[model samples]
Target: MCLAIPMRVIAVDASGLSATCEAKGQQRQVGLIMLDEVVRIGDYLMISLGQAMQKISVEDAKQTWAYYEEILNFSPSH
Candidate 1:
């Protein structure tokens, strides 16, 4: 299964074709071509394959991250 990461927009290019996003203290440039709305700084986006697929609310982003963290921190009983 493919996982889409939640990242916050840090910066956007002048043409608005791409943006710089950060998550877990890591930063990456992702294409914004999939979105039709304005992508402002601090906006949370669902990123996949080096592209921002959709804009998500802050609460949604936080909840997703919480789930991710839980999975990442999980320990098997084996």
Candidate 2:
């Protein structure tokens, strides 16, 4: 299954189509070409498949992370 993770935009590249995002204390470059809203540093983006799909509010970011925490708590027999 694929998941869209909410990440905080830390830096934007000169090209405007890429950005460095921090999530879970790690930073990664993600594509911003797919976003409709103008992205800025400290913005929350919903990332999926290496791309930013949409801009989300801080509250939304918190909720998404809570969902991720829930997923992490799941333990299934492999």
lDDT of 1: 0.97
* TM-score, candidate number 2: 0.88
Candidate 2 lDDT over residue span 1-78, tens digit each: 888989999999988989999999988899988877789999999899899989999999999899889888989989
Candidate 1, 19: how far from true, in Å? 0.3
Off by over 4 Å in 2: 75-78
Report every candidate's CA lDDT: 0.97, 0.92
User: Lowest summed-lDDT stretch of 10 residues in model 1?
Assistant: 51-60
Clashes of each: 0, 0
